[model samples]
Target: MTEITLETRIAKSDEIVAGKIDDEFVMMSIDNGKYYLMNPTGSRIWALLDEPRTIGELCAVLTGEFKITAADCQKEVVEFIDQLAARQVVKVG
Candidate 1:
């Protein structure tokens, strides 16, 4: 089985808001009123925001779905989560 290093475990997804705008997706946290613009790849991650997922799982999923490098995906995934954290969209479990 794959593992995830998710810093935040989304128990209640109500805290975050998601919607599509034009060709892009946007997710916002009602708690902090902070919004994140989700690109194609980011949107994929957003779609999988039901619960906590390990970094490895995310990396594997992304790599399998897209033609991206695992290392690159890992870095981006961590950075994206960091951005979400900065906005208080997610919290450490």
Candidate 2:
């Protein structure tokens, strides 16, 4: 697996089915039949994944919307994306 960096582009995996309920996002991996739930911030990231985006781009947008420093946002976002990638809910390139 490729390491996720600031320049890495990411998008939702085709094998994952997802939906929004109220303020949260729920997703299921067709390959494993495992379900996942996301908080508001994660939901926002999921929505942004409608188009492939660089990790840097995601951090930029999220920092603008939330009160977080660039470094902290990048760290958190990278960790979150790593989890999603591991679950095959997202594709990283």
Candidate 3:
């Protein structure tokens, strides 16, 4: 499994096809033919992944946009991105 660091740049994996439904996101993986459901937060992250951005940048943006503390934001964002990366839902470089 790949570790997500502050410097890691992440983007949506090419194998994923996603769309929005009633304020949430639904995604399908072409590689495995699996579907995923994501909340608004995950959808926002997915949209931001349209272009490669460092994990630090991602966390900073989330912290500013959301009402979360920096420490919590870092921990949660790292874990979330790492999980998505591990599943090949997002690409990390």
lDDT of each: 0.68, 0.94, 0.87
Q: Quickly count the clashes in candidate 3.
A: 0
Q: In TM-score terms, which candidate is top?
A: 2
Instruction: Score every model by TM-score.
Output: 0.72, 0.96, 0.93
Show model 1 residue runs off by greater than 4 Å.
Answer: 1-14
Find the candidate with the highest lDDT and give its number.
2
lDDT of 2 by residue, 1-93 (tens): 889899999999999999999989998889999999999999999999999999999999999999999999999999999999988899999
Off by over 4 Å in 3: none
In candidate 2, where is summed lDDT lowest over 10 consecutive residues? 23-32
Alpha-carbon shift of residue 19 in model 1 (angstroms): 1.6
Please tell me which model should have the higher TM-score, number 1 or number 2: 2
Error of 2 at 88 (Å): 0.5
lDDT of 1 at 10: 33
lDDT at 24 for candidate 3?
86
Tens digits of per-residue lDDT for model 3, 1-93: 667778988888889999989878899999999899988888888888879888889888999889998888889888898888878998888
